[model samples]
Target: MWARRRAARQERLDRVAAEAIAEFEARVSSMLATADESHQALLELRELLARELADINGLLAPGGGMPVEMVRAQLEPGDDALAQMDRISAEFTAVRVQVIGKGAADRETLVPLLEDLGGFVEGMGELADNVFGAAEATTELRVNLQDARKDLAPLRARLQPALRAAEDELAATRGAPGWHVRQVALATLGDRLAALEEGRVWPTPEKTTVDLYQELEHELATLRDEIAQTPS
Candidate 1:
């Protein structure tokens, strides 16, 4: 009877321990999901920045008042967030292996790691905000170009040509993969542009709208450039 009692107690202890680990892992997964969402936002912002700069490069006249070198300078802020995310990704993978992948015991150390990760996620968001004068990099570039032009009438008129150009590219390849995403980006960018204020007080966008089309335009675009590269 004593032996059976001991076995039952051991079994209960084991089950309780397993439930604890499962709870811990669920918490960890939720936290890491936040990072994944943030990382993707950084990626889309980086790609959009690259595309807008390239677009501006295409639009500028030779010896155009703005040099490509000048236009490209804006990418600096967001790159750090991307680099930090890469490091976090590696460390996160290692932690995940211990907590969930191997079905191992939860480490007391991981609690500290989780706190640090949460902090890193917050910092990355702040860094991304520095790069966004608006949702897509398009309006940021537009404002830069507008500043050089120094006239709202001409600048406002020029505001949407790039957007129209992007839409036309997607329209040409209707029903193609990533087409829907490009369409959403158009809407996001348009909404952002319409939201622009007269004082040009560029608002810092929420860094967590990973829910936005920015990333969904997944397998996505530099729009015209990507579409051009796509073989008919």
Candidate 2:
């Protein structure tokens, strides 16, 4: 009877973990898409500015072989506009570069988090296998599994701060088109990952483990759907 109950619980655990994975995957996809769009938008802005500069330079060209100073005189009137455009372009370029760098950093930081979560999920799978494969599962083995879960908790917790920072940075730059969608995706990913970490870390009974896991699964599923619905 206990074995049957354990099998049922394992099924539930697997279901939740699968749901969480689906959600995390979707959010990551959304973030990458946003980064791509932002990059293209920055390129367009640069191209437009370049075209304006070329047009203005042509207009200020020396006519009738006028003196260089005379050409300079012709250009002086619109110099402020050129300067302002230069300044705006520089600022926009900087923001674009920063956003790209942030995206790369976010990916780097998230890799470890994903690995850590993978470990937790793997541990759960192994525990479930052992529980079912054994002729009879022992209390001692269950205790050891609990200890393993605890060990995994601290590593997962360590990632929360980094995850929070990535989310915050992503959110701070949401004024641009498509950026707001990415911010939402990043925030959702952070929250889901944190919940997974918490599910492992919480000092709860084995019986309650499935409940925590299922809750995280539900949260992740919702996040995934929301991300999919988010406009690019």
Q: What is the C-alpha RMSD of each candidate to the true structure, in Å?
A: 21.0, 38.1
Q: What is the lDDT of residue 130 in candidate 1?
A: 65
The lDDT of each candidate is 0.57, 0.47
lDDT of 2 at 11: 100
lDDT of 2: 0.47
Clashes of each: 0, 0
Query: What is residue 120's positional error in candidate 1, in angstroms?
Result: 2.4
Per residue, candidate 1 scores C-alpha lDDT tens digits across 56-96 of 65645443323334344554444454455456556655654
Superposed on all Cα atoms, model 1 deviates from the true structure by an RMSD in Å of 21.0
Give candidate 1's error at residue 189 in angstroms. 41
